[model samples]
Target: MSGVVVDVRGLAPVQRFINRLANPDLRALADSLGAELESQTRRRIAEEKTAPDGSPWAPWSAVHAATRHAGHSLLQGDGDLLDSVTYQVSGTQIRWGSPLVYAGVMREGASQGQFGTTRRGGPIPWGDIPGREFLGLSAENEDDLVGITEDWLQELMP
Candidate 1:
C-alpha cells in the first residue's frame, strides 16, 4: 500500500514573508524606536521652556536661588538629575526614567508641608515646590511613536 504525502514546497515564499515579522526582527525595530524616543525626550527636557500643557514651571524659590546661585537657570541645578535620565528596553517594553530618587517627586510635585529645614533654620514648606511636569509623554510624542512603529511594521508587509 502506498501512503499519501503532503507537499509544503509552495509555502517557502510565505514562510520567508512570515520570518520578516518574527520576534527577532520585531525586537530590532523596537530597539530603534526606543532609542529614538529616549533621544527625543531628553532633547525636550533640556530645551523646552513650557510643559506639554503649555504652562511654565513654578518660579524658583528664594532658598533655591540662594542654594544654587542660578535660580533663573530653569531645570539645571547640580545637573545630577538631568544626567541621571536614561532608558532601557526589555523584550518589547521600553522604559524611560531617571535614576535620581527625587525625580518622581520633582515631576509630580509634593503637597504643602514642612518636609525639610532651610539653611536659615526655617521650615521648608511644600508650597514652594509646585508640581511641574518636566517629563511625560505628550500627544505629539505618542503620535511620533505610533507613526514610527507603524512605518516599521509596514516594512514587514509582503
Candidate 2:
C-alpha cells in the first residue's frame, strides 16, 4: 500500500527554523509557504500529461524532468528558502513511486560527484562531510522509513 511511510517528526528543525524566522507569525507563514510550495509543485508535476496506461516516455524520464523543473522553481523562489529548508529539514534527493508520489532531498555536496540515494537500508553520506545536506528516501518498508526518519532527526539535534 502507498502512504507516508516517513513520519514527519524529523521536520522539527525545519519547524524551529521557521518559528525563529517568523516568530509570532511562524505558523501562518509556514502554513502559507507549505501550501504554496505543495500547490506549485503539484501543478508543475501535472503538466506532464502521461499516457492512458500511466506510463512515462522512458524510465525515470518524467520524474526526473518534473523534479528538476519543480526544483528549479522552488530554488528560484524566496532566496531559495524552500530549497534550503527542504535540504535542511528533509534531504536533497526526491524519488517517485509508481504513477506519482516523490520523496527524498538534495544534499549540499556531491560526494565523488554523486547525489546520494534515498533507498532504505542503503548507505547514505551521513557524517561523511561537514555542512552537507541530505534527502530522505521513501523506504521500501515502514520500519525502514521510521529508522531513516529518526536518523535524520537525530542528526539535527544539538
Q: Give me the candidate number with maximum TM-score.
A: 1
Which parts of model 2 have CA positions greater than 4 angstroms off? 1-23, 48-158
| Model 2 Cα lDDT, one tens digit per residue, 59-158 | 2234433645433432232334332332111233332222211123222322421445556634454323221112222122234445545654454444
Report the C-alpha lDDT of model 1 over 70-156, residue by residue, as the tens digit: 333566676666677777888888777687877877787775553776787666563556666776677887788888888887777
Q: Model 1, clash count?
A: 0
Cα lDDT for residue 82, candidate 2: 32
lDDT of 2 at 133: 18
User: TM-score of every model?
Assistant: 0.71, 0.21
Supply every candidate's count of residue pairs whose N, Cα or C atoms clash at under 3 angstroms. 0, 12
In model 1, residue pairs whose N, Cα or C atoms come closer than 3 Å (at least 3 residues apart or on different chains), thus clashing, are none
The TM-score that candidate 1 achieves is 0.71
